[model samples]
Target: MKLIDTKNQLNDKEKHIGKVVGVDNATLTNIQLKAGEEIAEHDSKNEAIIIVRKGKVRFTVEGKPVEVTPEHILHMTPLEKHSLHAIDDTDLVLVQVKP
Candidate 1:
């Protein structure tokens, strides 16, 4: 058995990215962004699920804006283009599963 305290992994960096876990078929990533920081448009080859732990973020998926908060979760299909801007200091966990 193992335990991971996600909050303890946060740092006061501009765009802090940390790996929580990686295995044969899945990977877990931690992403922390300061307000106004942005992640450039990109596409992932694997299926993805993004969980917002705190704060707010605006995700532009295929040219549409989607506001995400702690109460929301986002999922992306493989190779779906997307980009995000931090509306507030944000913490997100991304889980990707191999096909």
Candidate 2:
């Protein structure tokens, strides 16, 4: 198993406001998000899970908005369009299953 510390991942300035911790089988991935930043709207044909680690985020699934906190885990089914915005400085782990 590959071990990763999401916080230790390098931030790519040209990319979005988050870093990819680990990816395998092109299915599962760990992501980290910063404050005032966002993961733009996108869609996938597989299910996904978002686990909040350190802060708040405004997450939208299929156009419905929901607030995700450290105590919450967000899950999305196949083909659902979704996006996330950091409400404050935050950290999140996104696990996506490929179709």
Candidate 3:
């Protein structure tokens, strides 16, 4: 069994927003976003589920912006463009389903 503590894994230095703690054969990564930071527009080859753990964020998927706050989750299919902004100091987890 593998267990991870999101708070500890996040390094506040390297990533101004948050750190990507990779696990499960790189199938999942957790990102911590500082207030006012953002994950610029981009796309992925694998499907991903974004789970908001702490604070809030604006998640733009396929050009549609959705507000995701703590306890909220959003899914994005492969090749779907998206972006995220930290409405507050946010903790996000990205679970990528590898092909």
Model 2 vs. true fold: TM: 0.73
The lDDT of model 3 is 0.76
TM-score for candidate 3, residues paired by index: 0.80
> Considering summed lDDT, which 10 consecutive residues are worst modelled in model 1?
5-14
Q: Residue by residue across 31-57, what tens digits does model 1's lDDT show? A: 998889999999999999999998999
How well does candidate 3 match the true structure, expressed as C-alpha RMSD? 3.0
TM-score rank, highest first?
A: 1, 3, 2
The superposed Cα distance between candidate 3 and the true structure at residue 27, in angstroms, equals: 1.3
Give the candidate number with the greatest lDDT: 1
What's each prediction's clash count?
0, 0, 0
TM-score of each: 0.91, 0.73, 0.80
Q: Give lDDT tens digits, candidate 2, residues 52-95.
A: 77779998888899999988888888888888888776766777
Better of 1 and 3 by lDDT: 1
With candidate 2 superimposed using the best TM-score fit, by how many Å does residue 22's alpha carbon deviate from the native? Answer: 6.7
